[model samples]
Target: KTAVRVSCGEEHTAVLTKGGAVFTFGSGRYGQLGHNSSQDELRPRLVAELWGAKVTEIACGRFHTLVRTDSMKVYSFGRNDQQQLGRGEDSPPSVPLPVPLQQLCATSGLVIENIFAGGDSSFATCVHKKDLCRRLKNDETPPSVENMVDTWISGCDSKLLKKIKKEIHETFSSASCMNRSFLSQSKDKHFQTSPDYPGLDFSLAQSVFKKLLKKEVLSTEVQAAVVQLLPALDGNPVGVEGLRVFLVLNELLHVIQKLKKQPNTRLAEEVAAAVQKLSPENLQIIDSKVTDVYKRDFFHHLFLRIVSDKPEMFMFNDSETLVWFSSEASEENVVNFYLFGVLCGLALYNNSIVHMSFPLVLFKKLLDVEPTLEDMIEFSEAVGGSLKYILDYEDDDLEDQDFTFKIHWDGMDVDLDPQDPQKAVTSQNKKQFIDAYVNYAFNTSVEKVFQEFQRGFFQVCDQRLLKLFHPHELQGMLVGEAVYDWEVLRQ
Candidate 1:
């Protein structure tokens, strides 16, 4: 909650958190506080009206306040007698409201780039989307993945395909070329690249690979460049932005395995080996589980609530203690989990552990080792204990216990035996129940988000070294030492 930006009016003050939340205080006589009141506030109070909007910039006029969201929409509050709010409303004189952008403005492709407030007026700068896109396109060197994909889809004659193949070699074969590729240019986020945030557009990377796969020639050339160049990437990259090459490459592997019905095993192996050789100088790691099990408690407390507290985006275990991403997490929220994974990768690459409260099964999954019943026990004591009891039961008639394939978890009734919804759990198939539950807990239920988290994680880490670690050891390495007992050493 530490303030990152602050702005002061004549009497009122505005504070912005690192998470982009805003707080206001000092005075509220003109509703500058955005609390729908004109009462003065002695202490800084959260601006509830702007909650979840993620304000990136704030400006204060003599009697008004303006904020620009990450989405670039502007919000204003306080005195608007001079029409400084730009709300175009005739409602109450003092109100917290978004600037009313006309429908034509959107259709005209006007993009808001900056905001300012001073004296008794508010102002915002706009750029034509077409011109902006043209400038960005011109800035791209070595031809972006989007440009390459678009050109291939436009039509692939022999001459163009040959040119494309050569371009692929020139682009991917050079570490500098690949390093400069796939950066997310929105809001200049790429300039802020860190291990915790690779600033690469993973969706763009994966999609580009998908398109490349369609044209056998382009995909093959890409495979060759990856096999040759990625393994030779600079371990100590020039800047954090250079780290994006690993992410873009890892995403290529993900697309090959997940999307290809007939994947090339040799290509997959070569690409995987290249990614596995990645040992970056800095490190990190998960969802709520990923954030929760940080090696250090400080990071755990600091980051856990950022994602875990968003109940609408994540579902908790029955105990409401552990976090599993909600299947219904909004598409935007799901992408956040991916970035969360990148940060986790940052922690891992730097040889630092974070507060990732995930069960041991997560580490097992990272190593590509399947989760087992014991992993289930470690994840959920009650469920795993009962499953163990059922396995140990001498009674031949487990049917007498009246267990069914239908089980509830994270507020959903999942059918383990979808083929036969009436399938009963008997002694003969009790193991299947355990397997299904474990899979549902660690895999099926949260597949999309976890996959994104995994992709984000491997963006910086090589799984070969991770695979060498046992689940328990990996867990300890990520979340710090769990066994605090010193008596063994004393003995």
Candidate 2:
């Protein structure tokens, strides 16, 4: 909020704040504001495009701007008709882009100490590193495990160790900092982060974590820093670049396991809690665009009515609190089942919510894990209770239970054996009868709709990351564990 310096163009203004944040206001006709737009700003607005840099100085031309960062890199934007930006004519016209100086620095071994821009001229003064209070930062790659370990072991009492520790805290506690880290900087490929290629170096994260674990001090610091990262995480991070942190965390968990350390189930569960709180509340709300409001309201309205709207597709317990696919499904509305799966997918990918928690059997089915009679017990107490009761009965008492291959479910009768509809259930065949019943409930009766639902659910987060979780873990991540102690829940 405190301005360190201010520069004025013909009609624009640039303010350099104390913490090295830049803000702009007034005319943006030629992008002199450097806020990535030509729209005029009535109030000073922060230029968020430059996230990681420590901007030391700012200058404004008649219709352009330039900034120098501690990283010894100069970025320029706005009118470049005279090539004043130190970039080619094809460079971006409005957005602040780095002025290509890597070759100049590499060959001349020069450190850019200062930068200035006005009219059609700009300058970068080269100087010795001794002239500055500290060594000038170069294009900062993230801390390598090898370097961090060496520093931790060798610089225990030195200022360099202090600097590394500061960097560690900043990188772990800030989402943007973590997102911009672990890049594959070759050919500047780090700038190209998309769904197909997230541009994260997972191998780098693994190597760093592995090395850090070797030193007790460094290992403790790494765990502390990562734990510090949780409170700052905003679920459904913005852009593919933001997703890199999550991938890095995933890799970190794997490395911890390979090191034979206990996987942090509590950490994972805490993260899952944060994940479930992902809300569309942060999205821009435009009145004219129905979709802008659809995602927010959809969870509030649609999910509130899902069970009531399609009672035939799902069977519920006596209280209607528990739900699963009906054995007697309606073929006419099979597509609705798929759409329901899509809603579940949206919950995973888009921060939508379902009103009720599904049984663990649902997650098992989604992960292609086989369901058993015990799982059925959680799904349907009456059916599962009866099957277990029959199985527990003595050979003489089994006949008194009227055991048969035929049973009634969801208002429809289903035969365990299609070949023998009236087959008897005896002690010799009790296991066979229970297995058939479990198969019919989880597989035979609902396979088609479940497949479609799975397709729809995976459509959003349908990536392979689903395999990292066990069925119970996936259930926790999706539905979350119920809180019995409300007063003890973390805020």
Candidate 3:
């Protein structure tokens, strides 16, 4: 509940937590407090609407507030007569709502990097994109935030949408270039031939599609326009058109996966049907390269959400599809890059122990596929050893909620001299990199997070399996004294 930072509006104040939670207090008139009410709060109160979100920063205008989440989403609530909220709505918002930076983000693929407010107007900024710099040139007017929503909703930019649709159509209509586009690197303009799948901008389509979705500009007309074109690529598994269709569907699945609510079943079915249309040969290609398709700016958001404890962000419920994917990936051969991503996520999100249900057999196979030593030891400690020692056969009713672990990181020993010209990567630099990596994985307390994952593992696994971990091994894991090989831990 500690506030890492606090901001004050004209009369209201908002606080952001070390844990990324948001709380607000003071006046709420004009909805500046972001709690969806105009009444003043005498003390700090949680903004329930943003419960699952991790807010990183907050900015307040004279009579409004703008908060940015770690996920790059910005929300505003308060006075907006000047349209400072950046929303399309005519009236002020009483609750925190997402601000549409869709147009700006579509061009830059950057988050709201900074925000500033004036007496009557609000300004937000995104990371400058090199491509935008090249495209805008020296003569264009400076960008303005006015009328964004109006322009978006009224389709004032319908030509752009049509252009995108046409590009999709033409790309997929050709039979020669389908699979190549999906795996092609971004192309230099001078060397590029086809504009649709221009030199390695595969992620451009992904970002554009996501930007369109975020803007609330996606229309039924647009969806139908894209989906209706799919039939033309039938039987031509490697056709250029089929690749285009898959790209759109893949981005849609990513978007739908991030929704906190029940998915749009109709859209899901449409996407599923499209996936089903891929012949077995084509399906193998997709299965092999699925991870590559997901490596855009949206990957972090999608990975963080899907690997969450409750894990409902994505539905891979098609058993037949799962079988296909699994067949292409194994200990001797790995097809999907996401399999390792999932394992890394499991290690990071503390789901490492759940793999114990397969009796460590599946976990062993994964280790062979990618012998990332650090990940394996972290996973082993998380799933196997640490929890049994801590819990020690407690009854179901025995709650040890008060137990906590205090962790500390010792600095590394580096003897290399930085002044030596021959030593580009000094020992100190290597140590720094290693420490930084470990800190990122474990956050502040490496020991505490490691123990917590172990606790979670114990909470999930059967009591009988506690015997699988030897006492000495459990002690070694808990004290951070173990050296586990990626090859040996699974055994």
Candidate 4:
């Protein structure tokens, strides 16, 4: 048989064949040979116990062997005095046996990708999948909020309840939960449970979340509970809870939006303040060491969900936080590029939703803040080069083409100085405040933002924004050269 993979212990060897079989040889002092007795194998011996399963990978310890199957099942044999094979029991098995880690992995919400072992210790790297897909694959019914509450109560201790209450109290009393430097951390430092509250399981926490999403519950109480419970999410040893966290955060967002209209102004503001803290910078923290495809895609889907489900939230609130990383600052942490990629991806994926909103301004600010052509190109590639198309276009030869521009000056004072030191308009600061106001007007003679770009008044933009344009709609920049010059004169 063709050997696909091979690993060796201190005095034994294990080989994975292309046909999904394992062959063992050499020392059997600790049952490492996988035979029925502690006898050395002079020749390659097929691991008969694993005859039905196809072994995809293999790892050998000092006196034990670990193998992973094509179906993600893991098995082990040999020395178990140190529990190196991960069987829990101290007895060594003379034949290859399944590791039985599926239950633990499932509870933690991770897909086992690979097995690792050495020096009497072993590990299994896990990946995170989209929560919705995982639930479907597992055939789990979406438990009702009442059911979830009962489940939480049944599984958790009094300490967890007290902790949850304490978190709520602290959150409402705190001025704000927004962390300005969230993107600057070199390690995974997002929401986490306090060390004192031990044995908090993902299932129990998820049930609490489902219960909070129900309309029958008091919004304030649920809001407080969510804020308090967020930290416990940090307890994810495997990345399975990545999807759970995403869902929790999204549900909490809806709660905040509803709370904004409630009568309790103090509680509403507290909830809003806490909501603001859940920016891409904070929530998108990923462990660099994790190489699991599911875990990575989990975050990717989370970003997409935020942009697609709540475009305005990302455009007005989370998009503004991109300024936390200058091109230089981004180099200090990979999360900068990762979050930016999400923003770019957001614009690309939800181009129609964000086109009339603040997305273009976000692109402009990112181009300006990005320190290098490489980073700029990376940002551009993230959005499929639509950004570059917007930045570089010729409108001079388009005089014959009909164009319109729309600028919202609804709240601006005509006399405000654009050049005043106290009112100085930084490029990003301008984009941050004005982009939302910069929108397409759906009228016969409506002005367009692109005309300003053609006239060398507004920055250049491409036809991507035109995706929002109607057949009768005008296509031009919102600000005109005359208006721009007038503003300069007024300043």
Best by TM-score: 2
Q: What TM-score does model 2 achieve against the real structure? A: 0.41
lDDT of each: 0.72, 0.70, 0.49, 0.46
Tens digits of lDDT, candidate 2, 1-491: 65778998888888897789999899888777777778999999988887779899998888888988878778888888888888878766778889877558657656777778868888877765555435435546656545755666676556676676776676666666665557776655665666566676666766777876666556556667877887677666656465566566655555665674565554444443433333332111111112322344344344545665567778776566677787666776577676667567665554544666678889888888898998878877888998898778776656556788997766779988989998888888898999988888888888888887787677656548888889987776666675456778654
Stretches of candidate 4 exceeding 4 Å from the true structure: 1-62, 65-221, 229-241, 255-260, 263-338, 351-491
| Candidate 1: tens digits of C-alpha lDDT, residues 115-188 | 88988998888889888778878985555668867887665665677777777888888867775677777876
Winner by lDDT between candidate 4 and candidate 3: 3
Query: Which 10 successive residues of model 3 have the least lDDT summed?
Result: 320-329
lDDT (Cα) of model 3: 0.49
Candidate 4, residues 102-135, lDDT tens digits: the string is 7778887777777888778888887764754565
Tens digits of lDDT, candidate 3, 358-451: 1121232222222233432343444223333333434443223322222122222322233442333222243343333334333332233223
RMSD of each: 22.6, 16.9, 25.0, 19.2
What is residue 111's positional error in candidate 2, in angstroms?
Answer: 14
Q: Clash number for every model?
A: 29, 0, 8, 19
Superposing every Cα of model 3 onto the true structure, what RMSD results?
25.0
The positional error of residue 301 in candidate 2, measured at the CA in angstroms, is: 29
